[model samples]
Target: MTAVIDKKKCNGCGLCALYCPLDVIYMEDGIGHVVYPDECWHCGACRQECAKGAVRFEFGAMMLAV
Candidate 1:
């Protein structure tokens, strides 16, 4: 899974970056950016912590298989 932030919806609250356990998110120009996507644990912390609901998870085809 990958975390994607919508720049239009993001309020630049920085909560996503703060809540990321692996420090995958970083703040730049007051916006949360996924700087280390490879390090993300797919824990959903960033998405959950986003008050504006800017963060979303994108699952790959392999993860969608049942």
Candidate 2:
């Protein structure tokens, strides 16, 4: 899955970049962006930490069964 950043929602918080285990996300023009969307491992760590909900899945996600 690819991670998508909503330019309008991004606040340049740097949370995605910090939480990214593969270092795929980064900041640009005071906004957060996925530098390497293909490198994302679908770990969902960034999605949980992002306050703005800027990062999203492009291919849709499964509802993890509890």
Candidate 3:
């Protein structure tokens, strides 16, 4: 799954970058961006931690159940 960030909703909190287990997310010009999408574990930690709901999943909703 890909973690997509909405620049409109993103407040540049950097939480997604900080909390990502794989250390894939990073802040670029105060915007959250994924650096290593192929390593994503779909753990939903980024989505869950984003208070503004800026981070989202492109697929694998069922994997979140586990």
Candidate 4:
């Protein structure tokens, strides 16, 4: 599984980047982007910490419904 960043919902607050323990998430051009998806620990820190609910888990062909 990998974390997906919603471009529409993301305000580029860098909260996910700050919350990510593995330093996988980063801000680029005022947007949240993943630097290394494989490095994700799946600890759900980025997803849970995002108050805007922009970050989500992508599992195969399905995405976590909030």
Q: Write the per-residue lDDT of candidate 1 for residues 1-66, one digit (tens) a residue.
A: 889899999889999988888889999997889888778788988888788989998876777995
Clash number by candidate, in order: 0, 0, 0, 0
lDDT for predicted candidate 3 compared with the true structure: 0.88
* Candidate 1 whole-model C-alpha lDDT, 0 to 1: 0.87
Given candidate 4, what's the lDDT at residue 26? 87
lDDT string, candidate 3, 1-66, tens digits: 788889999999999988999998989898898888878888899999999999887865665777
Clash pairs for candidate 1: none
Error of 3 at 11 (Å): 0.8
In order, what is each prediction's RMSD in angstroms?
2.1, 4.9, 4.4, 4.4
Clashing pairs in 2: none
Superior candidate under lDDT, 2 versus 3: 3
In model 3, which range of ten residues has the least summed lDDT? 57-66
Lowest lDDT block of 10, candidate 4: 57-66
The alpha-carbon deviation from the true structure for residue 62 of candidate 3, after best TM-score superposition, in angstroms, is: 17
Steric clash pairs (candidate 3): none
How displaced is residue 51 in candidate 2, in Å? Answer: 0.7
lDDT values for all models: 0.87, 0.84, 0.88, 0.88
* Shift in Å, residue 6, candidate 2: 0.4
TM-score-better candidate, 3 vs 4:
4
Sort by lDDT, best first: what order?
Answer: 3, 4, 1, 2
